[model samples]
Target: MRSLVQILAAVKELRWYYWGIIICSLLTAATSLLTPFIIKEATDEVVASLQGRGGGISVVLWLAVALLIADLSNTIISNVGGYLGDVMAARLRTRLSQRYFHKLLTLPQRYYDTALTGTVISRLNRSITETTQFMQSASNNFFPMMLTLVASLAITAWYSPWISVMLLVVFPTYMWLTTLTSKRWQKLEAKKNSHVDIAGGRFAEVIGQIRVVKSFVQEKRELASFSDHYDATIGLTRSQSRYWHSMDAARRGAMNLIFFGIHALIFVRTVQGAFTVGVMVLLIQLVNLAKQPAMMMSYLVDTAQRAIAGSRDYFEVMAEEQERDELADPVVGGRRELAPDEPMIEFRDATFGYEDGVDVVHDVSFAIRQGERVAFVGESGGGKTTLVSLLLGLYQLRSGQVRVAGHSIDQTPAELLRGSVGVVFQDASLFSGSIRENISYAHPGASDAEIEQAAREANAHDFIMGFEQGYDTLIGERGLKLSGGQKQRIAVARAMLKDAPILVLDEATSALDSKSERLVQQGLDRLMKGRTSVIIAHRLSTIASVDRIVTLKDGQVDEIGTPEELARSGGIYAELLALQSGSKQDRKKLKNFDITA
Candidate 1:
């Protein structure tokens, strides 16, 4: 009920439309009610005329015209109301979609870590679609049905109070039955939705990683898993449908029996001359009118239950806490100046984990001076990427703080903090778009000359020009259309175009062949110049030129010094350097520390 109320409150802007729809519905109901009364008048007049005591055929014709006009009015108003309902529903969908999209953007990154792309999309689509459809249906049907039922009962009561009493009795009984069915139906729906969401999530994963699946030849396995989920839903549906329809049949049977008694009573009263034949016709029509709502009660209950379930799902995401933005002073033009003495980036005793109580980055501390280049080197799972992610403000620290450009990340606005840094991840996370669009993603307003210049600096200009569309060439999803080196170079170009004061390179060139690595490394070298750069690399040769090296082991910083100093000191960095130099003895010694080459 609260979820339904929230849905209504969300569309307050469309209240006038709702009011108009209600007015039309009321008017429609009023026009429809006039038909039976007009028929009753015409019938009595015809009976009197046949007995030579009334005005004759002319009165019947006039009343027939009145009935036509009433029905026409009812039809026109009902259609107009339906049109307004449709418009309201479409506009409501737009507003709710925008709101949900905005909430997704503002949600913390952690929310997405375990969230599946397809499941999230499915939830958004299904929930909003269900809610919008229900509101539209309610606007078109609910009020008209209620008004017709009430007006019919009131008129019936005027003629026969006992008949009206029977009509009233049908409602609560129908409602009680529907309520029971709806609760069980909603539970089954929720369970079905869980299976659907999982299937949808896995479907998207399989499609996106189709290449991986094909390479490993797991097509049959994935298909079986996907089919298994759907098969489970089918079983549940069979049970759910049987239960719903069976209950509906029983409810309808009970309603028919009660109406049978009411009809028989009306017939006996007319035959006994307690009521006129015209009055009998009117009462019968009114009974049928009242029955309409009672018949539709089950359908309305089903729709309402769906809306409630969808609303709960939609609001669950909306209720998640948004990322905090405490912008005391917004950074002007997306960059902040750093004092000469202050570090360009600093992590003070930083500790963090993807989950609580199991820290991935321990109490690590480091700082990079302005324009100094540093590289983080360690074995896999050593928290190098995690540390860089902290600097990027992607995750909050479990303890301590990360300051970028003299602003504490926790206290700074995300846009301000992130806008000051540029990153080139190991995977070139390019979207499905043209090359120009991807290059200018960070700075959408970048001019063509600026774009070409950045591409040139990243060594991507020659290859990009090789294509027919050059910069305008389309890159498929995740840059699938391009080679690994080409994609990495484009990512580098994107980072260069951002031109932020701080830079992060997370194994940017590690995934490429020797020739491709050289090309990308050259671009990295150009990008790192005159900027404070934090690099994560497993390749030892790349960090030789860096001003300092930070080696992590088991989430703690084991060594922090110049590469030459670490090499001489024989720490983890030294052992890694020796292993890379093909020293078998060093490999055996490093294995004792759980460091792999």
Candidate 2:
């Protein structure tokens, strides 16, 4: 209950609805308190009729009407309070979901590399539902119970001071029992929620990679793993339920003792002629009202514990500091004005890695003149992709500087830096949407004619038109429905639609078949015509037409020259060319040179 109050307090912007809930709750409680008084009045009239003194049927009629009015008001107002509570829950859920998504957008690349996709999704989905359920319980059950208990005690104290005093004593003991039970339940609920998360994460993982399960014929194994997680969750839930019911039994036993004591006190007072039968009836009704709060104690505590567990998870994500952009400060914005002869891209003593104090790309320096096509050739794990990531502002520099058209990458806004450069990766990413949507991703407002033109330039127009739905074709998840060559062409067409001044081809055509490679390469050639291009390639043949081939070894520049010049120089580039061309004589010469060195 305390935790639920804290949650409501933190969301102070919804105070107006909170006030509505409070008002309706108070009205319902007031109406309920009137029932005992009405019952007492009708009882006195019945006694008078039985004794044959001042027996008036009209008085009984008036009391019955009053009881009906009180009940009707209580029912209507309680429903209204329930409705307003749901409204509050909906708003809180929306605000939380929006915050989680917005934080995701602001998080740095390193977090994504380490975080599990399924776990994150499960956390976000569960937190909202659990928190809202708690709110509903608190509003509909806990709040009304407290109000009615308090109101009943005050009226009873005014009428029969002794009975009220006895109930007051029992009240604190019942609350103490509830408090102890809540603490233990909270710990158990936390453990239970973790099992739930594991189950949800596994479910999402299986759905996301169903193809792998089918290929490996591991469906039985996967099912067994999921069953283990589900069993753990159910086991924990059953344990919690058993513990709750035990505590509830104790609470009910204590309430029975209090009820018996109160009834005895009323009977003695009536026998002593200090109280009438009508007053005893009223005292009995008040005792029942007092028991109501204690009876609801288990439910309220369980809900509060669950709510606290969920809110803790939700706020933990919210507490993560959003990744701050180095270039967040305002700057004079325009097409970075540079001298006509200045280099379009430059890296000077640039050193970077995902972690601090360890540089995978160390002390590397190079430059590409405007409109010059350059290719970077390197072995696996030679930091080729890291360099491209730096250019796109996906990472911050550990030391030194990288610039595009004389503008420092660290000082330029990430969106602006990425907007000026276009990229087509080896694995083309396409969402489950229409072909037209994927093509116009960078320029969502692009007209049909403009999209068609871009597709034509990328050699994708004919293939796209061949589909029954043409541009409206719904590609399955990640464009799996399309052939490798077809997916690559659509990716190329998307980049072409951006029409940026600089283009990056990250081994885009490396995985295609010979025929697919030819088609994709044709699209690539058209896309790179007027743009300053940087091609990261493994194949020597694909980069032959580039103005310069820069060979990297152990994170340093080993050679940079025209392909023909590098082939004659007999350095890393020439050796790589020799190995790929499968020249036996050159391999023997290189092996002999390596032993001598």
Candidate 3:
């Protein structure tokens, strides 16, 4: 959660695995150094035997046995360490990914509104996979390599100080160069990832709305745009690959030259009789062992840098302010109490907007008593939906007050109102689930019988049974597999299952054809009875039976009366009704009615 090493090290459950890594690394290094010593011993033994020295064969036999044990144990321990590293990496991935997912769920609506789904998904995927790999790389590769280097260097220094001096001088320079190259690569790699994210977002956006694309005949245009993004991403990736290859080649070239020089020096020393051939062989082996870790350092450094960058992006999302869960906290010195018998719903001078100082629902004041069927009719953007959103506590008030069930909304717990008010939105949003599942969504533990009854009441039972799978039929994404009316009926079934004491329907049946609308309206009428209902509709006939109609214009209430009274008033409502009443031919003669205009 912090720096790469700190984050990995902080996993308490992996503490034992980390200890195993350290112990196994040390053991592996010890065994690795022992093999080269045994080689030196065998070489010495063969030289002594050729010179007719005593116990030469037995000495070689002992060294061979030691060599076998060292190499086998080293292999076994390294595998064990690698296994432990994988386990730790998997745990880290699971825990952090879960945390990120939960954080995503907690984020406010504004984040979802602005962030592209593809970009968010890409970041989430990389953050978990890359970060864990970076940690595992450090633990299994980087740390073990460092241990090997230390063990090999110690042996080399003990045998030959002159050789140790050369290693000290060349190795640090090599490491510094690798680090510098890795830093540059990390930056370029991050840039490449950005381009990839942009391309992914573009791709997802176009594909998700494929229907609209074909309808508008913009497939060719969308393809051109996506191609442009993808090409840019490919260009950035190619540049990054070029830099990586160049750095790798340069590192190898430098390493080969340095090692060759060291070998040449060792050969000269041996020829001058300064050291035996055995000593020369051991130094060479040690140098090679040390070089292995040094070479791995570059790749590990690159991974660490990339992980840091990815984690930063990941944590940045996690740091966003989450939606408030307080339900309601009353304002200081404001109304702290309410009458138990007050109207079921009241909005007193309530003003709010998505932005400050620009009210969408301006100074709106109204009240609906228990069991009242009140309808709100307004043109688009006249704040009909916004008002409903306010009542549902989807928004905070900029001014005034909203009271529900005899309690000030700011003082009442949100769950209290949420549990009491059932809403069927215009879109009838449904998940990719079975019909029974969708109906039970409002009440997850609802019995099958209860679900069936709700579906029957919503008039969705007949159509639902017509499917081969009946209630178990899989609805495609957003229930696209179902017809518009089917989805609406299922939505109503969901609301009916909730059996809330209050209901709000925002153009719930607006999208259905005449026959579908009639069927859905019948269910809606049953749902609205014996409850405090708020209906927002554009089709005047659908709401003609409501007890009262509140008309809005330019963010204020323009009229409030029974449908009969409003029709007789010759106001905006009367004009709208007359316009709809005209014959199809006559309607074409009149201009379209726009209340806002």
Top model by TM-score, which number? 1
For residues 364-416, what per-residue lDDT tens digits would candidate 2 score against the true structure? Answer: 89999888899887766677777888888777778888999887887887777
Candidate 3's C-alpha runs over 4 A off are 1-3, 6-16, 54-59, 161-175, 178-187, 247-252, 272-275, 325-339, 355-357, 392-403, 406-420, 564-572, 582-597
lDDT of 2 at 117: 74
Going through the candidates in the order shown, the clash numbers are: 0, 0, 0
Best by lDDT: 1
Give RMSD (Å) of candidate 3 vs. truth: 4.3
Residue 396 displacement (Å), model 1: 1.9
Task: Write model 1 residue lDDT over 139-158, tens digit each, in one string.
Answer: 89877878988999999999
Rank list by TM-score: 1, 2, 3
Question: Which is the better candidate, 1 or 2, if ranked by lDDT?
Answer: 1
Ranking by lDDT: 1, 2, 3
In order, what lDDT does every prediction score? 0.88, 0.83, 0.81
